[model samples]
Target: MSLTGHLAASLHDRGLGGDQASAARALRAVHRAMAELRRGTPVLIRGGDHTLIIAAAETVSARGLSELGLAGIGPAVLLLAPVRAAAVLQRPVPQDAPGTEAGAVALRLPPALLDPAVLRSLADPTAERLLPAEPERVGAPALASAAIALAKLARLLPALVAAPAAEAASGRLDLLSVEAGHIAAYPDTAAGTLTRVAEARVPLEDAPEARLVAFRAADGGIEHLAILVGQPEQALAEGSVPLARIHSECFTGDLLGSLRCDCGPQLRGAIKRMAEDPSGGVLLYLAQEGRGIGLVNKLRAYALQDQGLDTLDANRALGYGADERNFWVAAEMLRAVGIGRVRLLTNNPDKLAGLAACGIGVEGREAHQFAANGVNDAYLQTKARRFGHLLT
Candidate 1:
């Protein structure tokens, strides 16, 4: 069935009405659009007064590029986040615009650069070849910026091939359509849609009496977990704040015991500390692997790191921010578990601010640094120097 068909059936089953149905439809469209972009297909993004069709530069196929060229609206352009544009153009671009961290860039997508492999090289810094041509820079419209944002959401490189959408061509192409506004609002909207779905008693080696509560979005997206050790919520009722840790899932480090980072120790140690606390605590295990850039992009960043770039710069080289995580979801999970105030266990100050911004009152910070394994010493140092993590 089509994505729209699935959404329509879901809405009908749930009997959603009015604004709820409208919001659900918008979320469904964005979700479907992400899936389409990942598979090398195009989607149309409609803004307040304009519309554009965009495809991921890293994944757009030859046929997709042909469709953009033949749209009969205007010449297709390449849109990249400002950091990436600087890397590709080998010069600094403007960063004065609001909400455009260092500003984004739009380059005219010439016919020569339309081949899938060529476009992939342009989007991925890890590619060996130089760009085929010196593309001219053009002003990026709002929808163009949205296009890059959509690529990032799809867990592809934050680069897009886009063109103005002709009404007739948009209809004829039968492309999935979503709103730029909805793309911007997706993280918080999806966070708001979460509800506690299930709970089970699963004692851990570090945290005996651990109960895992799973939170799922209405659309059945990835689930965030709350590992409750003892009585954190009970402490809240007794007017005492409990300990909390916001841990983004690290599959390599946490699961495979990769030595390039300290995630495994931090994760296990946090649980032990929370288990020992008389007040007890809750650990919000988020599914934001590689700080929310997704596992594949994280591995790409690691490849860049092997070439001597630090963690932060490695992420930038791949056209992502220093961190792409949305702590709003963590805040929502904490709120659901009746944890409004907490003594947070973390080394990164961003977690403190992130929770506070989302109305989660952080009582204080409990230092949680572990000794660096010989392999990850530089990685830990990079965290302290570049990301301002409190390692001491």
Candidate 2:
């Protein structure tokens, strides 16, 4: 591989060539590796994709292998092959190995190469297995808020990128021709010049970094968002500190007292912990509403729930994958928050591996399980028993 922009072009400009069923099949295959972390790659060869496996790294020493579990790399380590590869990815190949130089890694086929029972296994020794998940509902109200939030983004992202920079700083936005000037906010940084266009005041956490940047979308809608930052002492750590949290966005529960799905409770718990001394931690407070089914779908799922369906069944009936949410967004959010390492706060082992695949270190995990109550018993049980969550 000459690094001739092959992989980048494969992923970026060129989209997949397949029908709906093929696309779904591709995704479902990746979903299969939710059990043990497998290693492989998505080959863009020929008409169909294939997963090729690497065996050299899998032959790691016992000492190195022991670190795999105790490292607390979070959940999906066993399930997500890409994440598993990173968890066990070694650098500077052993000097004792023959013929190969140091750092010559043994790579594998991607999970997309799901078949291994036939001759293809000889060509690429890779396999796939299913892991599971059980996500609770974000309720009707939260979904509505999330819809509005996403809609606002859909309308404003273009203009905000084109708006004059002066307006961004002054909170007074001015539209200019896209060709003339562009005012794009750094995606990695949320603390740019914020103009109070809508006069919406976002309340804050006790810390100085706890101010939500409120602004008017180009659509003339008022929006407020709060960011929690660690203090100077915690912000600048010598080594990576592992951190994790079950961040349920605070549309109603975290802000208003809605006993819907413990979003409020979890948000409080995450903030309290994040406010502590900064150690590389994993806090995945995602913007995924109703686990990415969106507000309308979430409400629809709720309707099914009211009709005597379990939480998982309700989502399935509503044409969702039980967990429609993708953790990649959470991974990006964590990186934006200056989190490089983390001790994930979750019970779903899959989530751990997902974050690790996305490049966040998992030192350990702190289980976030709510006390059993009749109202949430079904939801909790599905998570612990069905979804493979480490509830106990």
Best by TM-score: 1
lDDT of 1 by residue, 1-392 (tens): 32233233333433223376676786788889999999998888898878788888899998888777666377777788887876776776667643243336787776787889988988888877556446577767667777777788788999888777786667787788888878877776677777999999999998887999999876567899999998999988998889999999999999999999999999999999988998899999998989889999999999999998889888888888788887778888999988899999999988887777677889999999999889999999999998889997
- Compute the lDDT for candidate 2: 0.36
Q: Best candidate, lDDT-wise?
A: 1
Estimated TM-score per prediction?
0.91, 0.44
* lDDT tens digits by residue: candidate 2, 194-277: 224422223335333343323322222223232444532254366546455645454555566655565665666665565563
- Cα lDDT for residue 232, model 2? 22
Off by over 4 Å in 2: 1-226, 232-236, 240-242, 246-252, 277-284
The whole-model lDDT of each prediction reads 0.82, 0.36
Quote the lDDT for 309 in model 1: 87
